[model samples]
Target: MSYKILAVNPGSTSTKIAVYEDEKELFSESIVHSDEELKKYQKVTDEFDMRKETILNSMNKHGVKEKDLSAVVGRGGQLVNIHAGGYLVTQDMKEKLVDASTIEHASNLGALIADAIAAPLGIPSYIYDAVGSDEMKDIAKITGMPEIVRESFCHVLNSKAMARKVAAKAGKSYQEMNFIVAHLGGGISVSAHERGRIVDAIPSDGGPFSPERSGSIPLNYIVDMCYSGKYCKREMTKKITGMGGIKAYLGTSSCLEVEKMIEAGNTQAKEIFEAEAYQIAKGIGELSPVLKGKIDAIILTGGVAHSKMLTDWITDYVSFIAPVVVMPGENELESLAAGALRILKGEEQADPYKK
Candidate 1:
């Protein structure tokens, strides 16, 4: 049986839309939104109509009719923490998507766009592997201080997808293996997948420094900086996640540019690049104990995983823990479609988001 699914993924500056018939993709497009164009909206939620119109236009241009769609799936945004799986979009979920306090990301627009298009046709809208999906164990929640607790806000959609892929390649079920999957991208997330459940995660904003995010910083120094009056709260927040990492040190977030500089004998560039690998390896080491060092495989994925130079550095340090698997780039759009298809085929059950 064939099912037609539309997957919508909104990013910081672009919206990715794809149409899939069962497992095969009919067509996909990434609509780029310029910084200046996005500047017109005060919040990411404000651009909902603009993004929805763009998606409809793209679908019309591609001859994708609403009547042919079996369902519309979207990239999950931050909501109340729930299990990892496809969720039927509800009115409560839509409300949380537009709540800035819940999550202030372009991805929040994903469900809104999907619902607007799907609702008129009476087709169900769903979201799979939401970023806020939390499966962390109780012990992993404590953070030494009573006031703060760790959140499982990593790249759940991509990390979990890679885990299943690697498990399949190993001729084993994901439920039968323990693995540490690192999603190295614009923002980095390293997580421990125990058996089939993600028991721990080093969220992108708090884990190893990535292309643009600062990762973990010295607590005392950050406190001092907050009181220093040199930067406001908004600026400070941007500094930690956007203007941090290599962008903060060498003034560029492009890993390819850093590699070019390293090839030209730029010692500072090479050192900082290696430093990032070092931090990533350290994160892997930290999570090894979470699985009691019984990790089956260490999978590396995402756009940054395309760089062998960086991957090599990370591999050299963590190879002893487990064999490394490098799966480059993200398959989020296809993953979303596949997830929705699974529910359609009764291969997997869709989980509900309880308000």
Candidate 2:
């Protein structure tokens, strides 16, 4: 009854592939694409063949037989809003991913590469917990401005996976537990999971500033800065995301480096690091009301969650809401495989991709 699965996760500069037999990982490989190499492609989708080839070669090197794989699961990409779950990789989904007008992201290549490899083998290819999955209530979308509506754009894959993991550890099903998962990484996403669905979330843009993102900023200040002619649209966008937060404050983005600076008695670094932790705690607090104070556990995950200094600071601030369980690392590949396995084992049904 064991099933072999191949999970593909494409990031901005790397393609991570893994093979799992049931719940056990056989091998995992991360294929790094340098800036010079990636610059040859005008669009992210254009690198499909190259990425797919590299993945196949890695699998071959790892002694994985293509025909033996029961299913191929990929990290979901930017598409129209959909629910959080596994979806069969269909032609319609591929079309949406390649649409030129939509945002270009490296993740869009996941399904394409997966389908290319799985289709000839006559096996199903699926995308689990896609980036565009939105399960928020309509009320949560409201904003003070009529033109702007909040959208659910948190780290859906990792957050939901951690929620399920915590639920399992507590001897409960994910559908029977309520949890708030804070994914603290380069960007931070604090999500409120009610029952089995993510009811609401503080997406990286709307939540606390992280190591590389500005998160929520004063609108008036942003407007003034935009009109002030000191920067252009692209520069402003980078400031709000890539070049903001800790890097903007102290000239580096590595949490480890920041912690070292604090140990070296750098007052400014310590203050900025504490502020990041404070904002994360505030974001977690904001989602508590969304779950009605009935949260079973507050899970801390993602790369930055590995930092004891940061986690301890956050735990000290929000321990009253619920017990904080720090489960670090992204673990995206395993999550993708598990999602597909649930569907394959008939424990959960795979959702269809609409639009």
State each model's CA lDDT, in order.
0.91, 0.93
- Candidate 2 per-residue lDDT over residues 1-355, each given as its tens digit: 9999999999999999999999999999989999999999998988999999999999999999999999999888887578889899998888888998667899988888889999999999999998778899999999999999888888999999999999988899999999999999999999999999999999899989999999999999999999999999999999999999999999999999999999999999999999999999999999899988999999999999989999999999999999999999999999999999999999888865656
For model 1, state the Cα shift of residue 289 in Å: 0.8
Model 2 misses residue 25 by how many Å?
0.2
Per lDDT, the best of the predicted structures is 2
Clash pairs detected, candidate 2: none
- Please write out the lDDT profile of model 1 over residues 131-240, one tens digit for every residue: 88889998998998999987778888888888888889889988999999999998998999999899999888777998899999989999999999898999999999
In candidate 1 the C-alpha lDDT for residue 194 amounts to 93
What is the model-wide C-alpha lDDT for candidate 1?
0.91
Cα shift from native, residue 314, model 1 (Å): 0.6
For candidate 1, the clash count comes to 0
Per-prediction TM-score: 0.97, 0.98
